[model samples]
Target chain A: MKKPIRLINLGKTESWKTQAVYHALAEEMTDESPDTIIICQPDSPYLCLGYFQPFDSIFDRKNVELLNLPVYRRRIGGGATYLDENQLFYQFIFHHSRVPVALEKAYKTMLAAPVETLKSCGLDCNLRAVNEIEVNGKRVAGIGGGRINDAAVVVGNFLFDFDFEAMSTVWKAPWPGFRELAKDAVKERVYTLKQCAPNLRMRAVSDKLIELFPKYFNRPIVSGSLSQKEIMASQKTAQVLTDKIFLNDGNTDIPVQPRPLKISADVFIHNKKMFFKNKKINVSFRTDNDVITRVKVEGAVEIEKTIIGITIEEIEHILNSGSSTVLKDN
Target chain B: MSKKDYNFPADLHYDGKNHMWVKKENDNIVLVGIDAIGLDTLGDLAYITLKPEGTIVKKGEPIGTLEAAKMTGDIFAPVSGKISAVNAACVENPGIVNDDHYGKGWMVAIDASDWSTESTALISGEKLQPWIEAETHRMETQGFDA
Candidate 1:
């Protein structure tokens, strides 16, 4: 007998609630609680950070605040991403024991529905290695999953449109040509529905997912609403999800490097010189227990004040900000 | 250790069912880790979450989770016991699960309350090689790069 899984469609919600809902379901679901698959879209754009990533290292805090873009940290592990209504989210919560114990097996098994759905659309999308759906060598979706309490939650996006400019603007990439690098990186990796077929409505793609999930998982898909218990739990979880303390958790400043360099644990250095877009930045620095300390920078005086600390994040910030204009004018 | 180019360290006891390994640390403690076949098949581990010390966990219940660049899954406790300690290095740098799974990649250690009875469930020595071979064949059938 196929297990019956509840399907909840939260049409559109404040961005943070999108993450909170699935997290709450994962925490509250039991063997008795109906297995669930949620479909929703964010009402506005928000930056969602990976579980272990530090906020300071991943985002230009000053730029994010200046732009008034809200940020939330999800309990799931992955890199930071910009989320908006242009994408549809599917969140699955199942009893942990019911899922495959092997991580890769679970992904290949659960992600079949979406892969099948994309194929139905006449695109040869493959669930590419390491958590992405690729079509003709370009990524079409981002997938990530992790266990939250007794339930294992897998979350992914069906992208109708992507804002490369907004994405490049928000990510912390401190260096000259970093924004272009960010944009190029996205173009190299991701493909939006608009890029594929502008006429395809997101609703049609979502409907395809709804139609195929039951068939692929060998489960009955029954339409349902959140019980009162889930609503209350989700509301409480949303509060914590939006809290600054939760957002700030695990974030630390990463030291800046102009060029890629490998420093082993055994090697120690007090001074070094590196180039940022061909400009020499002489560095004087010390380390305490491998953490950078007492840093100074000479050359590139236009951005020296912002990068004297010598963290990758700081240099990226200066480089990412208006550094290109400074470089051009210099 | 290098039969068929897959690591099945002879000293470690194998949980053929779950694909985890057990190392008897002392009279009361036993260390748990994912074997090399598991490490290679799962790809690089990006995040590791283990139950905090002093938590009582049952045999077969999940004691932690491992997230890789591609997927995420639970780490089941092989014995019913109290989690005495977890690998801090694995938590901070999860790649060790792939780079050095047997040594620095050990997940957690338990102060077993029922090791004498529970350990009989685990297989060691000649038993592990065959079990690992079976697992590799199973992974190849599933389209993994085993």
Candidate 2:
């Protein structure tokens, strides 16, 4: 028998939408369900950084705090987001069985269904290999997803409205140069559905998701909720993610130090970070060539699990083409 | 120039664990480089560090590592031998990895005479292609980055 499709509605909420969806999907792990969908929105606007990106790269702590919105670093790869109430977010928790696991391929696969849905709305949206969907060269939607154990949830927002200026500028560091390009990259790369379409309503877009998903899916869709167990796990996970350490500067700087021995070289190229700022091994690698064939980590008395043995060939592929995200079997 | 028909170099190979591949140009001859796909996903690398040559290294030794964004992944040796050369071009411009992975992206060369046992672990280009394609698919579902 086809399981009933799990349909949830989160009209408008202030918390991180991605966290909410992830929490919901994590909650459903107790039983294997065919499908579960949670429609939610954040209480206010905030930055959402990709899982692998440093938190500092995308947000300003003081600015965000004053605005009263929280920042969330998700487990999915891709750029961050500035989500607010004007935007309606949707996360459909489907089994990894939803598609074969190829990071790039899976990214493409998850996009097809949504793009098809957008096309049905009379918008000529197409998926770009760069992990974006666009109309007339303007991005209409940004997408990224990964799997944990058995399920994969690709969550995104259908922009009902957004403040482009706010997104374009905020939390910017006082770097010496390249400020303008960075800002432009953010604006050019990101866009809202409403801004791109300028015609579609939030309800219509959400409805399209429900209608089109069933057509291509091979499994049952069942309505479900976040079980208590999942909520507990999510809260714990959230606490760790929200930890102050991760919120500070990436801490990637390797200061000039005396402990690791500042083997100074006349080679000039990498001037961004200095080794041993004050005679201490800061957490940074020293690279003279374009490639890193060795690592010098200071402040670490001992290598806990130093990745010493794996050859560059073995890791090169894993680090470059390979991608991973957290999704539990529900 | 016609691209060097890239292959999983014989001497330098993978244990399929998570390191790099290397090759022997001479008995002690060596060339170090990352497998093709590895370069694809490590976008716009920011930093790298390699051990200097003449260093007597063990089989599973820390050759170096690459960092992108905030996350850093280690680069391991295909075989353990003395360090010969480390690519210095990657110093100022780490983008060579994403731009020219095969030629300019070569990491380090080691003149190791004992890569025979280690060579066994490296995946062959002929064999690696299918495996990587399959692995790529596995990565997406399992939450692995590719």
Candidate 3:
């Protein structure tokens, strides 16, 4: 027998309302409560950061303060993104035991509805990676989730329109020159629905999703509204989300230590984190003009400017050799 | 243990519905952790946040939140108690839950405030065997095994 699901279409709401309501609904979930699907769009612009992401690591606090742009952190795991009214948000909240237990399989199953909706619109989108949708090798949508009380929520978006400049302003590169390339990368990697259809309305896309979700999930969708308890809980959550202290909880000042900075536009440092014998080793290095420029090991020991002109592969080989295992990277 | 294996030691008391195992460490303290089936089914772990060290937790109350890649599950107390200590290693590296769930991944230890009353609600021995096997079979039918 098909299961029952409650559909809450919160058409257009304040930037925080979309996050607050779904979060509150998830918090109040119990075994007796029906599964839920929330669809909405933010009316204003805001930068939403991931739960584990440190603010200063991804965004410039001074620029955020100067621009007076609002920012909030979600209890979800993923990178930050600039969200506005153009992106239609869908959050699927259900009991953890009610869904597939495998992570990759679960995400693919839950996201199939949105993917099929975009496919019907002639976007040729497919669920790629574990948590993203791709069209012609470019990401069209992003998905992430976390647990709240007894519910597991998988949240995703339909990218109706994207603001590249606004996105670049919030996301910071490790250094200058790379920031411009990073912005260029965003334009190169992400695509929007309007890029395919000349005059597709956000409402039309949302309607398609609403129509298709029932067929994909094989559940009867009964339209519903927030309960009184959910409303009061969301109001309380909204207050907590907008609090300034909550936003700046992990803010830190950058040290003036002389670091090997990115000198060229093409040189990009990849922060690779590996777990060897339950110990985390983080390595940061970049090739400058086809030559290894600098190697820095952070978060374990102070080995700054200790090794240079050696390729990352050679460093890996030496590290793996297990003879001189003194420097552990960040 | 095999990916399809179901192993709930007979000595450990379980809140079967919630899928938690509680092992009495002393007269008043009990060590709690998610069972192998729960760990195997919950996908890879990303983060685990436990209730603060000294907070009083009620039986069946959530003591921590576990975030897998796409889904999140709660870790509940099997008995009413005050959290005496938390596993620092598991919080630092949550992968241990998948790698060694029964050993190093033990989540918390509670100083049972009312051990006798709360302990009565837990299941063990004969009752736990059928419950775990049925739950495992149900999960396997849903395509959860690695």
The alpha-carbon root-mean-square deviation between model 2 and the true structure, to one decimal in Å, is: 14.8
For model 3, give the interface RMSD: 6.6
Query: What are the lDDT scores of the predictions, listed in order?
Result: 0.71, 0.54, 0.72
TM-score of 3: 0.79
lDDT of 2 by residue, A3-62 (tens): 455766666664743474574464354336545667776776767765544555545556
Better of 2 and 3 by lDDT: 3
Clashing pairs in 1: A54-A251, A174-A316, A174-A317, A255-A311, A255-A312, A256-A311, A256-A312
TM-score for each prediction? 0.70, 0.56, 0.79
Q: Model 3: chain B TM-score vs. truth?
A: 0.88
Worst 10 residues of 2 chain A by lDDT: A260-269
TM-score of chain B of each: 0.89, 0.77, 0.88
Model 1 per-residue lDDT tens digits across residues A173-226: 444343443455465557887888778888898899999987788778999998
Tell me which of candidates 1 and 3 scores higher on TM-score.
3
* Candidate 2: residue B22 Cα off by (Å): 7.6
